[model samples]
Target chain A: MSGTLPSDSACYVYGIVPADAPVPEEVLGVGDPPAPVVPVQHGEVAALVSEIDPRRPLGTPQDLIGHARVLDAVAAGRTPVLPFRFGAVVRDAAAVTDELLAPQQERFLAALEGLEGFAQFTVRGAYRQDRVLREILEQRPDVARLREEIAALPEDASRYQQIRLGELVSEELTARARADADELAARLGPLAAATARADSSADQPVNASFLVAEDSWEEFERAADGLAATWEGRIDLRLLGPLAPYDFASQLVDARGRDSWD
Target chain B: MSVAPRSSNYMSRPSSSGLVDVIDLILDKGLVIDIYIRVSLVGIELLTIDARIVVASVDTYLRFAEAVNRLDITQDRSEGLPQLVNDMQEGGARHKTRGALEGVKEKVTDLIGGDGEEDEEEQEERPRRRTRPARKGREQ
Candidate 1:
C-alpha cells in the first residue's frame, strides 16, 4: 500500500524562502500518508513543499502541528518564509515558482526582511476564581441574588443544574472580562509589539497573542512580569512564544496558495 | 487625534505579538485563497462543532435551579434562615468561583472534548433517553 502512493497529486506548498534557507531535504507534513517536503526554487526564493493527497483529510491536530513544524524549522534558520495556511497546496513546482514565488517577489522579500530578528508572544488571561469571585461579590449586587440562589442548592444534584449555574457564572464573568479587556490592554499595552484579541465566548477567558521584537524580548518579558505582579492573584496571565510569527504573518489577510483543507 | 489614537491603539493590540496569537490570525482570520488544494481531514469538522458551546443556554438555568435546591436541603443545625442565606451566599460565591474555573475547564474540554460538556449539552436538549455515549461522540 505504501509503495503505490502517487509521486505528485496536489502538494500543499507553504511559503517560499531564499534558496539559502537551511531546511532539511526531508520533512514530513500532515496526514497518515505523510507528505514530504520538496524544495522548489524561484531565483533567490525556494518553497518548502509536501504532497497534498486530496483523498486524505486535512486540519487534524496532527496535520496542524505538522504545518507549524515546517515553518518553525525554516523560521529558526532566519529564513524569511511565506507560511501557507494549514492546507495550502499548488499544482506543482512550476506553479509555486511562477505564481507565488514570482509575482509576490518584492512583497515576500520585504516581509522576510521585516520579520527577521522578531518573534511571537501569546498572552492568555485566566480569572483566578477565588480572587475574581471576591471581586465579583464586592463589585456587583445582582450577583448577590444569583449567589443566594446558588447557595440554596443541594450538593448532590443533576449535572444539568451544575451546567446551568456554570453558564450563569460564565456570563457574569465574561461581562466582567469584556470590561477588563480595556484595563488589561492599558496595563500591558507597553509590553507588546502588536496584538489581536480572539472571542472565546463566555465560557473561556479572553485570549490574545502579541508579536514582540526579538531584541525587545526582555522588555516584553518584564512588562508581562510587572502585569503578573500587579494583577497577581486576580487574573492568571500566561505567555507563550518567541517562536515564529505565526500570528502576525502577511497571510493574515491574503491567500498565497490553495490546499485541500480549504 | 482620532487617527493617531486609533493607530496607537491598533499598534498596542496584542495581535502584534505574533507568537501567542498565531492560532487565530493565521487559521481563523487570515485571507484564505481557495485555489490551492488544502488537505481535507475528517475529524476537523468536529473542532468547529465543538466550538459553538460557549455560554448561556437552558442547560445553565436548570443547573442554577438545582444548586439552589441542594443548598436549601443542606440548611440544618443552629443556623437561622437569614444566617443560612448568608452561608448560602458565601457558598454561592464559592460556586461562582468554581463556575468560572469550570468555564475555563469547559473551554478546554470544548477544545479537547475530554470532559462531558457535550453530553451535558445534549442531555439538556434531549432531556430523556438516559443514554450517554451517543451524545458524547456526536463530532461536528
Candidate 2:
C-alpha cells in the first residue's frame, strides 16, 4: 500500500505558513490511511499537506475534522497559518510546489508576515428568548393587546389572530436582533486588528470573528466578559478563541486570487 | 492563557468540539487555489440545510404561538411578565431546536437510507481530533 499509494497519491493541502514556522509533528492529515502531514516549501512560504487518493471521496465529517485539526495545531503553536478551505487536494507533490506554492509564494509570505503574532476569536451572542419576547411586548402595546386578546380565545377560535401574532413577533424579534447585533459590533470593534461580521440566524443576534494580536488577547477576553455580564440574562455571549486567523487570512488570499482563474 | 471569568451565562471553548462549529469554519472559509480539486460534499450540504429548518417555519410559528397563548393576561402585570420570561428562558431554545429536529434525522436517513448508515459508520470510526480553541455560545 505504501509504494502503490504515493504513485497514485494526491496531496490534501491543510494550509500555508511561513517557511520558518514549525510544523506540528503529532498532527494527522485527511484520508483513509491518515497520511502523515508535512510541509512543502517554496522560497518564503510553505504548504502543509498529506498524501491522499483523489479517487476516493473526501467530505466526511472526519475529513473536515482532520483538515481543521492540522491547521488548528499550527495556529495553536503560534505560527501564522493561512488555512485552506476543507477538501483542497492537488494532483501530487509537484502540484503543491509548482502550481500552488510557486505562484502564490510572495502573496502568502506577505500575508503570513502580516498575520504574525495574531490569532482569531469568535464572539457570538443571542437574545434570551423570553426576555426579548417580553421586551417586544412592552415596546409594542398593540402587539401586547393582540397577545392578550389571543390568550383569552380558544386556539381553534383565534386562528387568524394566532397567525397575526406570529408575524408581529417574528418581525419584532428580527428588528431587535439587528439593533442588538449593531450595538455589539460597535462595542467590540476597536479591540481587534480586523473584524468580520458573520451571518446571524434565528436565535443568534450577534456572530462575529476578530483578529487579535497575542498581546491583546487578555484585553479582548476582558471586554467580551464585560459585555457578557452587562447583557447577562438578556443576551448570552460566548467567545471562542486563539484560533487560526481563518476569516482574516482567507479574505487576504481570496482577494488576491479573485482575478486568477485556475 | 488567561481564563475569562467563568459564568453560567457565558462559555468559551475550542470550535473543533462541535459539529456546527467546525462546519462554519471548514465549509467555506479558507484559501482556495484553483488547481485544487473540489469534491461535491452532499452530506455537509444536507446538514447545513437541516440546521436552518428550525429558523423560519410553520413549526417555529406554532411553538411561538403556544408560548404566547399560555401567558395569563389577567394576572398582576409587572410580576407576571418577568416570571413568564424566566419560565420561558428555563425551557431553553437549544433543547427545543434539537427536539424539534429529531424527525429530521429520520427523514434524512429515509432519504439516504443504506448509504447514509455507511457514511455515519465511517465518521464514527474516526477519532475525535482536537487542536485549537473555538468560541461557541450555548445558544449557537
Candidate 3:
C-alpha cells in the first residue's frame, strides 16, 4: 500500500522567514506523530519546514494550526515572514530553495524588508443580531411592517412575506456592512501603514486586516478599543495581531497567478 | 528565549485566535508556489465554504427575517448594559461569529499568523481525509 508514495525526500513547508529569523524551538509540524520543523536556508531567506512522509495525507485541523503557530511564532518576534499557504509539499528541502526561495530571493528579501517593524492586525466584527435587527426595525418602516405582518401568520402561510421581510433585512444588513467596513477603514487608516478589506461572513459587518508599525501599535490598539466600545451592542469587534502578515503576503508574492485578493 | 508579547495596548489579544478567525485568515490567503504538490484538501471546502457570508439568497432572506422577527422591538435597548461591556472585553465579534457558524472543534494550538491562505483547488482525488462536520446552521 505504501509502495506508490513519493520518494522519502518530501518536505512540508510552513512559510518563508528571513535567514536570520529565529525559529522557536519544539514547534511541531503535520502528521499523526507530528514532525519537527527545521529551517532550510539559502542566501537571505529560509523556508520553515519539516520532512513529511509522502504517504501521510496532511489536511488535519491540527496540521493547519501548527502551520500558523510556526509562522506566528516568528512574526511575533518582529521578523518578517512570507507565509506559504498550508499544504505545500515540495520534493525536498532543496526544492524549497531551488524552486521556491532561490528563484524569488530578491522579491522575498524586498517583501521581508518592507514588513520589518510592521505586523498585520485582523478585525472581525459581527452584528449583535438582536440589536441590529431592532435598529433595522426602527429605521425601515417597510421592513418593520413586513416583519410584523409575518409574525402574525402561520409558518407555512407567511412563507412569501417571510422571504420578502428577510430580503429587506438582508439589504439593510449589506448596506450596513458596506458602511461599517468603510468607517472601520477610515477610522483606522491613518493609524495603519496598510489596510486590506476582507469578505464578511454571516452575521458580520466588518472583516479586515491591517498592517501597523511597531511604535504605533499602542495608539492603534486604543483606537480599535474605542471603536469597539462605541458600537458595543450594535456591532461586536474583535481585534487580533502583531501576527504573520498573511494579507500582505499575497500581494508581495505573485507566484502561480496567486494575485492580491483585495 | 521568547516570552508572550506584553508589548502594546494596540495588539490587544495574544497570538491565540478563535477557530472562526483562524479559518478565515489561514485557509486561503497566503503564498502559493507553482511547484508544490498538495494533499487532498477535501475537508477544507467544508470548513471554508461558509466562511464568506452569502446574504442575498432566499434561504438567507428567510433566516434574516426569522432573526429579525425574534427581536422584540419594544424591548428596552439599555436592558443589557453590563453584558455589552463583557462583549467589548471578550465577547467581541469572534464569539458572535462562532455562534453563527457551526462549532469548530476546540483548537488547542496558540498558533499565530495573520488572516489565512490560498483559494485554488488542487486537482487530486480524495482518498482518506476527515473534514469537519457539515455547517448546517444556515444551510436552509
The model with the greatest DockQ is 3
Docking quality class, candidate 3: incorrect
* Model 1 Cα lDDT, one tens digit per residue, B64-132: 334333343233331211222122221232232222222222233333343223432232122222211
Estimate, for each residue in B66-137, the C-alpha lDDT of model 3 and write its tens digit. Answer: 667777766766333122222222122233233223333222222212323211101011111212333333
TM-score, per-candidate, Cα-based: 0.61, 0.72, 0.76
* DockQ of each candidate relative to the true complex: 0.09, 0.19, 0.22
Q: Where does candidate 2 clash, by residue pair? A: A239-B135, A240-B134, A240-B135, B14-B133, B14-B134, B15-B134
lDDT of 1 by residue, A1-262 (tens): 1223344366566666667777744555665566677777777677777766555545543455456656655654545565765566555556666666676666556566666565555666555444554455556666556556555655454454455555565566668777666665666555665666655433235466665655676666667666666666565555654445666665422433211112
Sort by DockQ, top down from the best: 3, 2, 1
The residue ranges of model 1 lying beyond 4 angstroms of the native Cα positions read: A1-8, A24-28, A150-168, A251-262, B1-26, B29-31, B35-56, B60-140
Candidate of highest lDDT: 3
Indicate which candidate wins on TM-score: 3
Query: Candidate 3: where is the Cα deviation over 4 Å?
Result: A1-5, A200-202, A254-262, B1-15, B35-56, B77-140
lDDT of 2 at B56: 37
Local distance difference test scores for all models = 0.48, 0.62, 0.63
